[model samples]
Target: MSRFVRQSYYRHVYGQPSKREMCFDNIKVSASAWDTNLAAANPKFLSVNYQASGGGAFLVVPLTHTGKLPDLYPLCRAHTAPVLDTSFSPFSDTLIASSGEDGKIVLTHIDEDRLTAALRLEKPEVNDLEPVLRLSGHVRKAGHVKWHPVAENVLASTSLEVKIWDVEKAACVVELPQQPDMVGSMSFNWTGTLLATTCKDKKLRIYDLRSGELTSMADSHTGIKGSRVEWMGRLDRICTTGFSKFSDRQVFVWNSGDISKGPIKQLTIDTSSGTLMPFWSDNDILFLAGKGDGNVRYYEYEADELHYLTEYKSSEPQRGMCWLPRRALNTQDCEIARAYKVTNNLVEPISFIVPRKSDSFQADIYPPALSGKPALSSSDFFAGKTAEPILVSLDNLSETAAPPIKSSLYASTPVVPGSGAVSPALPPSEPPAPRSISRAPSPVSTKHDPLPSSSPAIEQPPVSHQPPPSSIVAPSVDAHPEQRSSSSSADVDQLTKENQELKDELAEKDCVIRNLELQLEKFKTNQMKIIELSKNSLN
Candidate 1:
């Protein structure tokens, strides 16, 4: 085999699975079949969705309480149905939220002292803990819940519609425009100002959170299975993972500033049946974990391409997985990131560690991380105040929080409360059915209004053409009135009609070209799959 050589700092990184004694075992994982991790983790606690009988419940296990948990233990139970998703508050170690099939979101504050006392007992009772706050607004079952990256007491949950909630007020502050299809996945940018979402309708949409306007959108993968999206940290980039028409897993990286022009780069992985869940690290590393596969593929994303580094292979496959926050990583061990993989009855921690001979902290691998502090309060955030997250150095444990690093990568554009930069009234068009499951091209179209002229431009030309000449220029003030008016109304109408026709032609061609590009990509992917299969057979 011929291979090109390249040097990378993370080229030799490896995953170290937790020992049996350290793993959380004997817990019933949720079987709701939702496209969620079924787990949420922080430095202090790990929350796992529990398969309860009477109501939806999740267990919050402290990091020190690792072992084979009892058959019945304390659970944060309040929901009337199975819990679909759970997320820990970024600013609070004891605060966690859960969304349930009963269309409710509950916030529970875990009492560490009570939990500690229970863990010390020889036989702990099955204690049922209730939530401190209950939010009921979604008409349909809520599928996902997430906390704002840079704001305190601000949360987001998705159902038929995505709602931004102000936890302090216990109310839904911003109800985003309804989604066309069920949202498969959504992610907030680093600044928490813009949100990127992938929907079942096979479209990737970006929304300005402040105004609740759909800014730009594009066609995504064609497979009917779920898709996932993630915003690259501190960069104006978004990455999505989904299945192609032929069931091959594919990854796409888009310029967050302009999605109308389509993905800047794309690549197809293997023909895996499981969805690839994407995770982004502060070091620009992208980790792809297959839903059903034990192996995790990690890459360094630079220069608009994903450079393959290595893969972590294991014998036991994972049902779901979640990454720990960057601030929680062990800098002494040169741990760049850590992921918790939930198997049938155990949740194991896998730490991605970089090999080093020295015991000192590796500054290159460990950058200043988010200090788990909110930059803006709920009121300030909704009042149009914007601020970046506070960062702290990993080298010093007790040092003061570092000042927020300012970067020119993304501007804090003030979101107008009621601006229609991109029309939110676009009809929800169904994606065209696949011609055949094998190798046929899927006719996917993005039915979104054109982005405002002030938006960033992509490499490709805009879909809509320039306005007619008459609209671009005004009649000279010194021109003779009769001469200026000499052009008959019929002639002006003819010019307008021609301009419209030309614009339509250009748009049609642009759509055709994009479809052709997609087809070509599919063909290439198919060829590569065949070659790989052949090589395996020969070997």
Candidate 2:
């Protein structure tokens, strides 16, 4: 009754699930994603952390489906700390990158030839795994790694700093450093040009390669443990998950057009203890989020708001989880989304299928269909050239059916004319809104009629601390120092006004800080009350 298996799978990722009857049979593994930084699954293989007593191993298990690992056990071992995260390259079926406590980024090549041979031997087998390339740069544990969704030979990692690497050249091309705050999570926009990151300092920062570092930032969260970001496909909007001033888990939607204005949409997910990991489906129309628990909630993205669809419940709580690529899903079964959930000692597959009998192809999850080829240049990478990424549309819905948000960045055309390299998008409509935060002129413009019908020019995002792109000439302080006389009267007035504004800002911040401290104390008191109640019941 359940159909799910196709494509060449090179690895086995740990997942947990429960089904009606005979839908899925899970396999157990000694090495799991428990208390580890990562577990990932793509079309061909799976990567998970495998820790031994003396050292640590990053296992690349073949998804042989025989319910057993081939003779090649525990793939490879070489990390000083429990492996933090692993990512399979979107461009190559054989390449995977792993990072961890040792501050090492290892690119390992999977021996597909040997794996194919082992399958014919009548018993499962694994070949000796080794790193094909190693690049080290992070001073602290590299907590996460993500390959550019539409680019080849490119990867990004986060720890105390965010580094964009060109695997072909084995060099870090751009690095965004953070002090006094560690990055909790990072997600790239549909075009792979911008990255949204949530940090321990309770702020969300968006970084762009063209602009050297930290292009945008906003104060966010309060629990101070973890926060995460997910870019809504193709649109200029981004969704983030973090804590409130009282430590309650909340998810917020931001208009990157002017991040300083604050979140445009916010929701309180739950009071659960585990951090919430949110995933936006390739279709760009649905969102699924799972917390530290077994329940996974799905939502419909419509009219700039998230509408709850349903929740997937598992018998056991998952330690970690991952979603498979859209191309690899059983489209025939109306399967909209699939997740590999890692639990106690097993990884199971769970499918979110829609009920239908006509067997019609679902075009709503359709934008990812365009990313069939590698978009990055290997020669440019080897030459130490920081090439701009080729942007592709990942919008699964048609503009006629679903439209772009009121204040969203509207782009439906391709980056290269005749190439059809568009980021899936809903066509533009209406004018832009006044900035949510007042400061520099908004970098993205709405004044220009949507991108030309033929030529595609994606202006790079400006790097923080650097002069913004030359296109938007920002007014200089001395441009009109004195409109009245040669005395610079306007300049002196401007300074006096600026000083007053600064005083006002400081006073406002002080008041906000006092309010947050009070809330923290209040939460602590409630926690104490709950503890006392538990103690009395024990007595």
Candidate 3:
């Protein structure tokens, strides 16, 4: 008998000398939640969040580079309560939205010029950062936020309910009630029109923005704790990771069109102690699940079945993890995937790459994608006065225009002020037959759980421990971008040559490994053939 297991890779750890010494020494990251990101990425900067004492304010530190960690200061401070989550605007690099325990979702614009002016004056007391707009829709602490992939000024945040807001107008375009339950996690489909979320009630709810309908609600993991959902690229399907009724962790694939059919396929991972945080690769065929054990497992999905490919193992478990957006990947180096893993004192960048011999740039692998500029401004979005979103796909990313969305629901009905009620703007097309919607019972409590207990919190359970006393929040002083001090050009040339030689040697080794694998498969085929022939002769 023979067995095949997953291949593992090496992780290049970053973030040294502790986050305290670097601009966030005075701030303490909240231990009560894990929704806040330790690190996030954009072309201009990498944003890091640190919690303030007593849920009053938080600092967002922006690093100018990748790979190496420097002793840099935070770029700005912009939250009143402990920020639960922060996300970059899909259309703009300077604008970002944050959800806080103070029940406010704020939009902040980072002015590089403002930061630079303060640095020039060496004024640590300069705190000019404030939310351009404060949205108060959630009754409790706002938990999670995500921007629309293609639409302009379309963003969603979760609390006891879900609110879709347009920063341009400083208004909520759509508010989704959680049916008296709390949402665990939510993900948008490829076209940015459909959303899939897991609720604390153990139900998978699908929301279609075009139709303004709940679409479908089906039974999910049935476990008591965590669940996360992700769309399978262009495929009208979603993959979810959660615990089963028996507390065994599992991953399942469902047909988004007809979730009533339930999961088409299910793969049980393990009965580990920690909940899994699932991240789908940019291409959408590969999925990685990072857990508390410091091991990140990767699998390839095809036709609803998952093939275990590899795992990124580490000695230290990750407290938080976030993958760089597709555009941030270095395709020229054949670097397919990268993630920032946040620990207690340091954050590291983990790379997942394909073993290839080619060193040339591949445009096909780096296809045209979304830009930071939105088609419509905030005023234009509100002037249109429609909850119906303009949908776009990856294939048409370069079109540079948002097609006009025509929906009678938004134009004809004037919304009642401060009321969470609006006309349903679903399916601008034909109507479909109504179907029955049911909810799954809570697996943990007998209270007929309406998703009120906990959040998926992602990656690790809501962190219960804060940073040590050694770290202290202090007034931020700007430090210049950390650059490697240049040495003599001759030494640099020698190093470059040596690096190229090492890459060539690696390519050769990869070639040899491929040949050996091919031979192994051939030998296995021959062995099977010989056994079959001998059995026939005996018969």
Candidate 4:
């Protein structure tokens, strides 16, 4: 019976397994542009657009679960042009802001049950919800629209120029003039104390929010320049990227203290034929750079150095990147979640795991004894009858097995004078013996045997060793005047050489200017002759 029971247990432990199941499904939707922008209201809610089979565009999926994106419920559909940017208000999860090429900015709320009911009931007749506000002041296509970080009712719109709107009053609060060309991007500092604007003119302008004054500016990349600027949340810095004329795409970190100064640090990559889109995380330590090459790169910022963390790839080019506010450290499972616009009409949101914790198999493992635990316990040896007894034998044991004496190497010892004790030795017996001296050989006579004395005797030198006064005076008289004149002459020669070079350069410039002047004069003479001939013909 026992053997049968053991066999049954083995069978139960090694039984055939059931097929695995997936938690989420791959959601497909139609977008207008090759890529669509994705925004999440919360961990459980996300929003995306879908191309209507009939025509135009619509905000189809209002709030879909992060785990699974079900069929979209058509909520709002009023724009004729493709939506360029969409953003959820940071202050309220229910409210969202969207701007399209139609130059309209619509603010709407997501009805929770209406969305779920429409999906459950398979109702295709979801109503067009009324927008809380419709902003309509942009002259050209509205490129981007963003809600103010600290202001609940303030929104910013960017096109050729930047305009701030007071939503409650439905009035433009301020109009920022464009710098000669179009404005590519704009962002407000974390505290909403400063505003940063990037232009197609290859310049970044910073404005003081309180005073509404232009504070500073920096030169940006000259080609494929960055259309976005993000101020580091907790740092006095800003990050931007664009393609350079040098055929290299670069991202720069500029210091807020001195904007006129060049970039504090920069990262360059050969995109070959792609573009780079960068986004800043909540804490700013992690920066997400998405390339058109279908790869997203993660970088850790330490001071001015950007350390490469890892890279994730997608089959399609990523159009937008955002860091969702994770609920907790454990819940923050991914570094960055991206949205890829695969086709001109389809957008797929993909999230890759950042893997904050390493896999156990790759880490070092230790035996039970070495795994941070006590090897043995005193109770094991002193337990009752249930414990095994330890045997003691006298036959082979050493009689004088002095309770294993520990070496004094690690033990402390007291000092004993004159015995080279543990303590440092006393100062040497006396001041070190004085060094001995040696006598010089005489010039007039041969050297004689030197005495082996303990110390050398002191003596004074003869006066004949000193130089005569007349010899010294004669040398000074011969050299002083010539030395002074030569020093002056060398200085004159250096000045002459510098002056000659300047004169030669000036002469060449003059020659070129004369040739230009002569050409101008001849052209003027021919123009006068033509004017005189025309006058004669008219008369």
Off by over 4 Å in 1: 1-4, 397-539
lDDT of each: 0.78, 0.59, 0.58, 0.49
Clashing residue pairs, candidate 4? 31-345, 35-341
Q: Mind giving the per-residue lDDT tens digits that candidate 1 earns over 1-539?
A: 65976767799999999999999998889888999998999989998998766678888889888889865467777788999999988888878889999888887778787677667778654444546556777778999999999878888999978888776555576777888877778999876878898889999999878778789989989998989999887777899999989999999988877788888888998998998999998787899999899999998877777989999999999999998988888888889999999998899999999999889888777777888877777767776666667677778744343333334222343222222121222332222221111211011112222223331210111343444565544645755676555554556777778868975675465445434644775698899999999999999
lDDT winner between candidates 2 and 3:
2
lDDT by residue (108-174, candidate 2, tens digit) is 6676665556556663333335454456777778778888765566689888888877554455666
Which of 2 and 4 is ahead in TM-score? Answer: 2
Output the lDDT of residue 61, model 4: 48
Off by over 4 Å in 4: 1-41, 52-72, 327-539
Q: How far is candidate 1 from the true structure (C-alpha RMSD, Å)?
A: 24.1
Ranking by lDDT: 1, 2, 3, 4
Cα error, candidate 4, residue 84 (Å)? 1.2
Predicted model with the maximum lDDT: 1
Task: Please report, as a residue range, the 10-residue window in candidate 2 with the lowest summed lDDT.
Answer: 455-464
**lDDT assessment of candidate 4:** 0.49
Clashes in predicted model 2: 24
Candidate 3 runs further than 4 Å off: 1-28, 34-38, 65-77, 114-128, 363-368, 373-539
lDDT of 3 at 220: 89
For residues 206-316, what per-residue lDDT tens digits would candidate 3 score against the true structure? 986544578898998988876888876555668888998888998888888789889978888888856677787644335554556788777755445576765667678
Give residue 60's lDDT in candidate 3 (0 to 100): 47
TM-score-better candidate, 1 vs 3? 1
